[model samples]
Target: MGKIFTVLLVIVGFVYAKPEIVIEDPWVRAVPPTAKNTALFMVIKNVGDDPDTLIGVKTDISKMVSIHKTVNQNGVMKMVHVDKLTIPPNSKVELKPGGFHIMIMGLKRGLKIGENVKFTLIFEKSGRIILEAPVKMK
Candidate 1:
């Protein structure tokens, strides 16, 4: 009876020891066909007790997909590449314009409004999350 109880406790603990990540309101900026770059915005929510880190992003529409943050450098606004983005336990992170965003560079084609683009978000704890973001002119 003692061994069975111990095993059950361990199993329960393992089940709860993970990050629950949710992506919400994912969208990409709609740009003209001549445009070569665009951005993606979304809200990332971590509802679990464990924290998670967004390490990478993948998409076929662009040659490079990366995490970036807009910053004011010497009174000039610039987008800087970020290595990773962390979402704390039970908290949320917003990726919006002039803030933390996913930069899609060297686009093969322009993003049309009302169209969806598939993206694979790689997280440290939660692994890869596949989702589609619609193109909008927000």
Candidate 2:
């Protein structure tokens, strides 16, 4: 009887787990003191059963923020601004350097190492995610 009760408790806990999208490895690269642009990288995972779109990004430390993707066309590497990035259900999307990343332009000030930068990621279905990315020099 005790074993059955323990199993029931475990099942109940799993059923009541939080259901939402997850953000993984959210960090920012500390830019040079004279640099004017920097990027943030992260992996977004949709743990829920529904798809979600990252519609907008807002930050106080930059003059402009946008989703950007780098592509090689005709042997020329170009960076283009993307409007929205979608995260499929039960899948993960990685935003890393040299690929899809969050571009921050016109930095108000240079990012110092170990500083926390706050960002608000607006999603279409999962709502706004408030997160802070630690600045690293990697």
Candidate 3:
């Protein structure tokens, strides 16, 4: 009876434990009211044993959502589309200014400071993760 009870307790605990996901330093830079584009930055840390792929992003404020990476072509900054961003097992992937970012293009409305932009980020392994990026004056 004792062994059966212990086994049952262990199984229950394992079943209820979900993967640990950590999002760090999430922020959106406020753009000029007349500008058509802006960006978001954050670091996603996956503490699970398996890898995850960030496949898609959704936000209502932008007419289009895309994953972009910056590159220097002859000292000129250029943005390119990414097929997918990977978060390795027990690792963190950073989306920082002048690096990888979420490009919000064709802005439907102006983003003001102290406001939040909700984003749904879809992952291949761990499913979907939602992020709330606060707009701040840069």
Candidate 4:
């Protein structure tokens, strides 16, 4: 009985272990059906000891999702594509408006208010993270 109890304790610890990466306040902007592009915002925290690379993202709402960063060139603001975003260990990355964000292009359907968009955040080390991002104005 003691051996069985020990095994159970180990199992529970593994099951309840915290994830190396965490996401906070994930959301997608509500857009009209006619709108061609939209974006997703979130705060990603890496609490692990090793770095991870955010390689890609997937969503059924658009034809493709890619990482983008807003940059000011001369006096004009522009959005540029990012091949990959690295999240250093014990660091936080914010994907917010007028900054680094995820671009969802060629949306198949309009996003309704209060609805949720299925998002899959792919990482090089930590693997896939699937979550539902709520649609909101801000």
Model 4 scores worst on lDDT over the 10 consecutive residues at 11-20
Question: Candidate 4, which segments miss by more than 4 Å at Cα?
Answer: 1-19
lDDT of 1 by residue, 22-135 (tens): 999999999888999999999999998889999999999999999999998889999898999999989999999999999999999877899999999999989999999999
Which residue pairs clash in candidate 4? none
Residue 54 displacement (Å), model 3: 0.0
Candidate 1 achieves a global lDDT of 0.95
Q: Per-residue lDDT of 1-138 in model 2, one digit per residue for the tens?
A: 999999999888666643368998899989889999999999999997667899999999999999999888998999998999988878899998889999999999988899899999999877899999999988
Tens-place lDDT per residue, model 3, 27-59, is 998988999999988998888756678898989
* TM-score between candidate 2 and the true structure: 0.84
Q: How much lDDT does each candidate structure score?
A: 0.95, 0.90, 0.87, 0.90
RMSD of 3: 4.9
TM-score of each: 0.88, 0.84, 0.83, 0.84
TM-score of predicted model 4? Answer: 0.84
Over 1-138, each residue of candidate 4 has an lDDT whose tens digit, in order, gives: 999999999888766643378999999988777998999999999997667889999988889899999998997999999999988888999999989999999999888989988999999988999989999987
Enumerate residue pairs that collide in model 2.
none
Off by over 4 Å in 2: 1-19
Please tell me which model should have the higher TM-score, number 1 or number 3: 1
Using lDDT as the measure, which candidate wins?
1
lDDT of 2 at 137: 88
> Looking at model 3, which ten-residue stretch has the lowest summed lDDT?
13-22
